[model samples]
Target: MTVLTGEMLIGFSAVRGQAGEQRAFDPATNAEIPAPVFGLGDEAEVERAATLATKAFDAYRTLPLARRAAFLEAIASKLLEIGDALIARAHEETGLPRARLQGELGRTVGQLRLFANEVREGHFLRATIDSALPERTPLPRADLRLMKLPLGPVAVFGASNFPLAFSVAGGDTASALAAGAPVIVKAHGAHLGTSELAGRAIQLAAQETGMPDGTFSLLFGAGRKIGEALVAHPAIKAVGFTGSRQGGLALVRVANARPEPIPVYAEMSSINPVFMLPDALRNRAEAIGRDFADSLTLGAGQFCTNPGLVLAIDGPELQRFLIAASLALVAKQPQTMLTQGIHAAWQDGTRALDALEGVQKIAQGEPVKAQCNAAQAALYVTDAKRFLADGALQDEVFGPASVLVRAKDFSELLEIAERFEGQLTATLQLDSADHDDARALLTVLERKAGRILVNGFPTGVEVSHAMVHGGPFPSTSNAMYTSVGSTAIDRFLRPVCYQDLPDALQHDALKRGNPLALWRRVDGVPLQA
Candidate 1:
């Protein structure tokens, strides 16, 4: 077992925090794991981290793209070097299966490499140039150049659900660093041990790559004081977060209240509704039910894209689907959740639904004895009208549970779709015959979700250029930005246009010789040199 010092990393130094001692818990055993005591960071430490990050941003952002890319690759390599020990600590802290944590670790490193490739490609800079048109008929146009630049130091809030993939050196940190911004992470309390290990890997990578000293830092906080202080600090320019709606909104409020408000790209909440078209539901109701059950129970319904709401028209086919789904759910055994607080919250959400009028508890999975927190799978049924009337039905339960809504007709289904708040994804299970209805529903769904799936579930999100892991307000703070894929780097970047500047003062990307051999828009036309 690797011993942890639990000190906060600020620049190249590890300082003992003043917020007091905290420990990681084994959710599977419901016991405090015998681990090193972690120091909770306070306001003063946040100031130190913020100031260092701000100072480092200048030189770090000006480094060649290749060097920046190399830094990211080095971080990925270091993470892999700490492989087994990191995975074990993550498993103990999150109560996630070893296989699952292993897979997440792969994703975490894979994304870092992906970002490196994206940086070297150079297109992300969006360089453009329009030469002066002094010979034009009436007036002359001055030479103009444009490109995106980093948004200074960024603050990333770690997520509890994905200890490895969304914590310390996760997507936010990778993307921000790739965009040439310094990063200050507020580590999630649930996995401080895991976070400390990853932070050390990043520190080693920074040192090995000869990057700026304050390029990265990790802070611990048992409560919101540290996070609040970091976000409100003047040195911090932007924020990236993934958590519950309440937490995201709170950060948004803090950012908005800052002396110079900054953008907060938060992946907050989503029920991720799945719509079953009549033709498909009628043709393979049983199969769809079984598959849906599997997705709902996978990871104990901890995924942000979990199918928490299911929609279908009322009929015999719908009845068959519900019956099959209930049967599949009942056979599943209760599984451990991430924490005791999460399990207790899940129970409260389920109990609230069970007590609501016109909502029927279709079935619940078999109970299992566990040393710690566990959640039993559950399925509920309710009419579309009743569901639309009661706003609580649409709220996410954050566990292995889902609500199936039966609409009277296709029109009612459309109305139900319109009632949905913003979502990360809205899936459609359709066949050839359901094309027209699918088209109609799609028109409405386009405004309600970031990603629309055809004949598939949303649990598995592909990390690629085409993926959109963000949505309108409530789902995320900014729908225009994503927290996944190559484009995620855009969140930490801003465009700057230079007008009539001398060649000597211009950036190399916009220089006369086209030194970087980048793709740019020249004189209102596309140019690749």
Candidate 2:
């Protein structure tokens, strides 16, 4: 077992926090881990971290792009160095299997390397130039240059579901650092041990790369006070969050209420709806049913992109698919969720679904003997009219449960799609014969979701430039930004334009002669020099 030191990391220094103590629990066993109660952070610590980050922002943001890239690479290297210990601690703290933790660790580091490459590429700057038009018929134009710059310090809240890939040193931190902004993380209480381990790696990386001391910091607290304090701090210019809709909205409100408002990119709730076209359902109902069960039950259905709602046209084919899906769900055994609170919430959600009018519980997964905090898969069905009438049906269940809505015809199915709130992903399971129906549905789905898939599940989100792990409104506070991939750096950046500045006074990427050899839009034409 790795030695546990429950302390707050402010810059390169570890301080014993004065804000109470808390212990981690093993959800699989429903027992608290022995010894090493983690220290919680308080308002003072939040102020200190934010102040230090504000001080470091100027130096850290102005570092040459290559040096910043190296800093990200260094963090990745340090994480790899402690990979074994991280996996073990994560498994113990999260009740997630060793294999899952290993994969998540890989994703965590892979993203860091990807961001390092993005920093080196320098295209994220979005450099543009318009030379002086002194010979214009009406009036002369000033030399203008535009590019993105960092938005000061950022506050990243660790996610409970993903201890590595979405926790400390996760996408938010990686992208913010890649965009030349300092980061201060509010560690998730559910995975304090994992956060500590990852935080140490970041500190070491910053030190080794000669980055500013306050470039990164990690604070711990189980309550909302610390999070609220961090967000309310004037130094935090932006926020990155992934959690329940209620929590995300609360943070957004706090950030807005600050004397100087800031952007809060919160990846909140989403059901990630899937539609089954008629021909496809008739052709491979059983296979699609089986696949749906597998995807819904994956990770005990703790994924943000879990297919919580499925829409299909009512017919004999739909009945066949439901039967196959129910059987597959019934055979599944209960799996442990991340924490007791999460397990309790899952139970509450499923119970509410069962009690809703016009909703029928079709089947439930087998229960494991003496297993604590286990989530049993459940399947439910209701008509499209009833579903559309009841807003409660659209709420995310956040577990191994899915509701299948049976529409009377293609028109009703499209109506259901139109009624849906913003979603992270919307999937269409269609066959060649269903192309016309799919084409009709495409426009509405494009407006409703950030990503639309054909014949695929939404549970597995790929980390790449093309990925958009975001959606409109409640799905995410701002749909224009993504929480994953290289483009995520855009969230922590804001465009700035310089007018009539001398070459020596302008940024290298915007200066004449292209000192940085960057690609930019010069006088409305793309150029590289």
Which of the numbered candidates is closest to the native, going by highest lDDT? 2
Assess candidate 1 and give its lDDT.
0.91
Give the Cα lDDT of each candidate. Answer: 0.91, 0.92
Error of 1 at 247 (Å): 0.5
lDDT of 2 by residue, 270-311 (tens): 999999999999999999999999999999999999999999
